[model samples]
Target chain A: MKVPCAIVGSGNIGTDLMYKLRRSPVLDLVLVAGIDPASDGLRRARGLGIEATVRGIEPILEDPASYPIVFEATSAWVHRQNAPRLEEAGARVVDLTPAKLGPLVVPPVNLDVHLGAPNVNLITCGGQATVPIVAAVARVAPVPYAEIVSTVASRSAGPGTRQNIDEFTKTTSSALAEVGGADTGKAIMILNPAEPPILMRNTVFCALGEGYDADAVAGSIVAMVDEVAAYVPGYRLKADPVFERDTYTTPGGTVPARVVVLLEVEGAGDYFPPYAGNLDIMTASAVRVGESLARELWRAAGLSERDGARDGARDGARA
Target chain B: MSASGKTGEGGRPAFRLTDSTLRDGSHAVAHRFTREQVRTVVAALDRAGVPVIEVTHGDGLGGSSFNYGFSATDEMELVREAVATATRAKIAVLMLPGIGVKEDINRVAEVGATVARIATHCTEADISEQHIKLAKSLGMEAVGFLMMAHMIEPGRLLEQARLMESYGADCVYVVDSAGAMTIDDARRRVAALRAGLSIQVGLHAHNNLSLAVANSLAALEEGADQLDGCTTGLGAGAGNCPTELLVAVCAKSGIETGIDPLRMMDAAEEAVRPIRPDQGVIDRDAIVLGYAGVYGSFLLHSKRAAERYGVDAKDILLELGRRKMVGGQEDMIIDVALELARERAG
Candidate 1:
């Protein structure tokens, strides 16, 4: 049987998740829940013939058996309240907000490690864009300080993003340390209002300690970009990593061996325009996590791989 | 030649002109401005009675790295030359908080950069607090630049501008970095900022949509105190507002700018115009970029990406606008072009 999933928000990220979920073979998106009756997202979901509700999570709360997995794209404050309720009802949760209530997950870096957790938090967009590069650099060298600057189109930044600016920087920086394996991390976001809005560009500055292999670090970063590209096809490097032998003057003193890498994420025009790589990376990774979780649940239950596909086929035949 | 400040209905102040020939004008010359070139532009602008002359790489201070092309000469050397040559105009440096740090500010200030334009994305003004404070501490006139102002509503822009004002900015600018705003957009934002902040408000415009001059005038009528321009509209994308044109307009409108329009025209035609790669005019790429509300700096990057990916540049710009991409997302050009090429291939 195909795993039934419900998306618990009908914003850009949630609606994008619904479209990607349609392409997944393992999970079926049954309902989209939101509080806004006249939202474009709700209209789009209804147009797609999915059961969408403006009553928020009540629909899913009442019919827990129908939704075994839930994707919470609401704000952190909302998720903080809804997560426990979903867990009580025996539904797995993928929290897409900056809520750190669950174990942090980045599909390419550490998704598999938190598979069994009741709730998994996909960090902020900046975290999704830069942490992998930090992880890739840390794989080869001990990164003492890693700083990421993410510049996205201002139009791509929604009201939620504007209000949560502080939380985004704090969460992304923390994820850089906890998940990206950095001693200290700093995150800065720039919303470019340039016409033909600029694509999502990320600049990664990693301070490598002595006795580190530069070539190995480059190789690892390339490999990691490919890994992320598996899900986000537009994720690629603008140029080879640039290295400078310079001293960084900190509040304490000076540090050496600074390597800077520039990355650009082009979204796969799924639901957002291709320039919304920030949104793309988040939703794309969520799909990766959802599909993997679906497969994991199937295996644990001794269900065959073809069983889910067969169920989807039977559903399509019935429809 | 009108240096007289004719009072408005409510005695609103006249606009101050900031000549950006050495800074934004670099894009017109492919960011290869020599120290002598900067000195020449600075001297002429100062002699023409422009009050402020911004000098830095086209992308701002510390933007001379590989990602944003390497300058023909070092920026510090150029700053020194500008300081040595300008007679009356205050020297300024544009510093995005991350790209240009405290040390960069100190270096420029030490060499006599009297104004520091601390720029950040419109919604992220909090990040500019430190830089703005540092500029004030250094005794430099600090201006907050809310880049991509078209991306937010007037109330939101006012909030960001208030944060900059709270952080010690003497003036706050509504920067149309993409030249995408209509006259009403500029008027609404300037009016909001005027009502909200006690500090002075400025306007910066790009000519991507052929509305730079009109938007600047709109903002001026709505209580803008400072305006930025480049000689001959020689800057990024379709370039900035033409300095001579703005001065001429101010004169015609009986609003004093203390600038000689004839001198500005001489500077544009005799000095800056010869070195320009192409005169600033609204082309197809620039038009689409303006219509789609894309960043102005992405024009060249988009064109190159389109050529490399074998797709139409307009298609790339339209797709970028559809996605609501911003200034630093140059990499998406290639992604959009590739996607377009793929669709054609299939």
Candidate 2:
């Protein structure tokens, strides 16, 4: 009963997603596609006994109906080119690039809203990490301005991330508004080169409108952290959300009150090292979204819950 | 200009001086540079025969944010004013790869900025490749700026410089961002870059340790083709090497910078000094910044946070240094202050 899926782009993010997809219960990874024949990610997939191709999206295009879902982990430029073709072929895309081809999705925030969309953009890793917190605060009161700073180890950022740094900032900042529910959003990323590379860390600053209860806001943030942690086990607050008044200065004006939240994300060590939580959160969130889509596809086909359970049992026996 | 200190066809040791009074000085003033201020500074520098004048937010393009202080005037407006005022000088803008996106560079270029200085931390030069290439493709002079050069050795810095050279940089700079380098430190880094990079080498020194002038001289001896200075040393932390002082020294050392030293001094005294109350002096806090090897722009932010939270700014600086915080981590100033306040209260 597992929905068959394919992954395109054999880079750090694609390779990492490959490892996560293998453990997914509702989705089966059928193919990994890349342009470079000698790419380490493609070679690693072959060694894992999974089907991998150097033809990029050609293999998936040949038999598009088989892949109900295709995860695009390539660069934003490449995703822009592949997105329309993948959609015409009738495969739902979970885009991990900064290419904002469809509605942005943060699993805990708006996954259910975009389940029926042909494609869903995960924004950038920074957006995935900080948007939920902004949504949490916004749920209590309107956020006038929200700014996030994401610091990751230099070693964890491949050449793709380095070259597309502009797109990363723009997409993440826009998501802070479009997904995180802020009037204005600013994003900054830092590549830390400290020896013994540091875990991915984020600082989210939100400027709130008038008459919001601080206690209610703090409670909302705490609850949201728990929900995100349910999928991303290593996602946790480095410090409690620090509330202050009249500290943040936005383009509109100086805000009356603000809250600061610090977060550290440690990877699941699926493919990259533990410090590469930037990549981990994207793949983890993708898996969460892909599973939801698979469940919906099953329901659309009039499949019963018992069928899923029986299929799981059979797969377990085989293992 | 040659790395061997050879005299050019003009019959004197060739050297270039870039004035950064409008850009780095924004940090000392908390990033509140008015358009009039920018125009005045640019006019003064241009009149004094400065070949390059850099103008941007203190942290670079797109730096006006909640973390970094906001500019009083939009940076593009200020750049326009500088461009309109300067006749002899080519205008430059600083763009940190992560903080400032390509759109910011495009905007600056559209506003007539001819030079783009793409900056990164000393060890993170890989991030500057795209921006450097973009600048070059835009037909602008691209310079790779490596900040916090004192944190890494000369050999490692040269490796980073090599990365920038491979990215098509017109020149590479050994920037003592913390102002912690001594004469030897400056000499060795400039020498390494000059020896390793086929492109030109530049030096950007600060006066935190009161060695800005001496270090600039050492860099000159190592054949640094370009050097940055500010009018009256009006820049971040203890300010930068004073443009007037650097020109005077270069003249005394038999170097031809094509700048009028007396006009530069007059600009500092009449145009620059009156706008700011204090000269960029080597104060205790600034010295602590150098001693701790913290980013120079953190000075005012740390001081304000420490004062607001009722903690020691020096202690905050030392902790930031211990954590190896680089530039663009200005938000951590308030975080460190809050942590210290909680510790004291508990």
Candidate 3:
């Protein structure tokens, strides 16, 4: 059985998510809605035989049974207002905005923990790329603080992202602590304007507890990269983990024994250019979450293990 | 005598002054500006009536790392001390969006930094909107800086400046980070920005071609509303436009900077010059780097790479220029130098 999903906000991110769902096994994309009927995204979705609307969430509310899951891809401000209404309609929400009214989820790190949540916030793209690594380090040794700097091509950021800059930083930073298990977290984003746009590059600085073994931390981080790569095929480490012994004395105070990891995420060319690893990670991770949630609903609806295996065999045979 | 006093070439536009001695000068000291040095220099600049003083790693905020030379003292500590020392001047920081984040800006603001100059490449002003908006929301005076302004033409520069203005930059700067722009280049870009943008226009010049002061004058003639200078011309790659020289020139030309030239000279000669590794002068290396349109910040990295690989720094810089490498690609310096050394050996 396929769980029905609808995408609101037919912009770059929402449209991209629609394209990705075309290949999903369990989630059926039924509607692509936006504020602009003339938007290219809505036009494209209509051409693809998906129900496209400009009326926004009211239609989804009128026919809530058609969409069991709604992907909220609007700006953070819009999401803050729409989230409660969607919950009242009894539809699970996958928020792409930084409004973050729901529990934050990074597929590789904590998707299962928040699978039952009514709304799951994907956090920022930077959070998706770096949080798992932070979690891996936290598992090995105590991480007092973690900081990540995400650099992406300027051309990739849309106006909505440009407007919600504060929410982006605040949500990404808080998720590092709340989801990655870091004591404290800070996030920075850079938009590179090079002629040939650069790939998404991230620098993660984790302040490890004194006496933590460098090898163990590196080992755990490398393993975590592999797991994230299972969903985000473009995820990889730019270089081996570098250990630095230094005292960083800020006006706030001093931080000691820092371990730095440099990461680069090359996009899979799903709906954006290969350099748009920031967008790719979000869509890819959302698919993983959506599939898992669809499976859970199927099980809760009395679909047995044999039935799941039968569905898988039928899909395999059809392919 | 008002802090907001405006005086320019024809007594029309009132220009503001920002001092970069402690910030950009950190490059000359190998990023090792002591807390005491920051305290003393900021105090002197403040007394000299400079309106704004930028404080951060020479490359910008969050630049203290192994790749970029580590700062001798923490930048936030330097920021706090600079803030405490200044009485009239508003403390500012140079933040390249990728290098520093909102948290860093908030931390500096908490310590009393009231201004943020968000910088981007000339064509990439759109990237600065988020950061600039954040700065304005935090109640800081936000400025947009377009680095390597010589790389593009006036019409395009105006478009980028307009984008920044829409994003809430109080002012926009055409940065000759390589000190490569001639007087005409400065005039054309500043004129375009003045004509097209409703917001204020500014200029940041280097002295690699010994044209920092002259280029700055030309920009002011084109109605540039703000200018940057470093004490004793202390900054990256032949340093910045000398603050004392700019003040003296403005005075003689009947333009007002609201700063006393004599007092600025005392600060430059007594407080700044003593600690300088070298005065800002157009040496052969700086000339070549500027001639090739390479970034001013790349000089130290190229020099270090040349030393490590036993290659000529001049050849490395020229090759980097030919490759059209921009800032943040410092890793390529050593790679290019190594190739040059291999070719020489062959």
Best by TM-score, which number? 2
Provide DockQ values for all models, in the order shown: 0.09, 0.61, 0.19
Name every residue pair that clashes in candidate 2: none
Model 2 DockQ reads: 0.61
DockQ-derived CAPRI band for the predicted complex in model 1: incorrect
Cα shift from native, residue A73, model 2 (Å): 2.1
TM-score of chain B of 2: 0.97
Over the stretch B114-220, how does candidate 3's per-residue lDDT look in tens digits? 98999877877776887898899999999999998998999999998999999999999999988889889988998899888888899999999899999888887
- Tell me the TM-score of each prediction against the true structure: 0.60, 0.94, 0.84
Against the true structure, whose DockQ is highest? 2
What lDDT does the true structure give each of the candidates?
0.82, 0.89, 0.83
Give model 3's docking category: incorrect
**lDDT tens digits by residue: candidate 2, B162-271:** 99999999999999999999899999999999889899999999999999999998888898889999999999989999999998987887778888889999889988
Q: Which ten residues in a row have the lowest lDDT in candidate 3 chain B?
A: B1-10
Tell me how candidate 2 scores on lDDT. 0.89
Candidate 2 deviant stretches above 4 angstroms? A35-49, A247-249, A304-310, A313-317, B1-13
lDDT per residue for candidate 1 within B218-314, as digits (tens), equals: 8877778889999999887888999999989877887778888898888888878888747777899888777788777778767766776688988
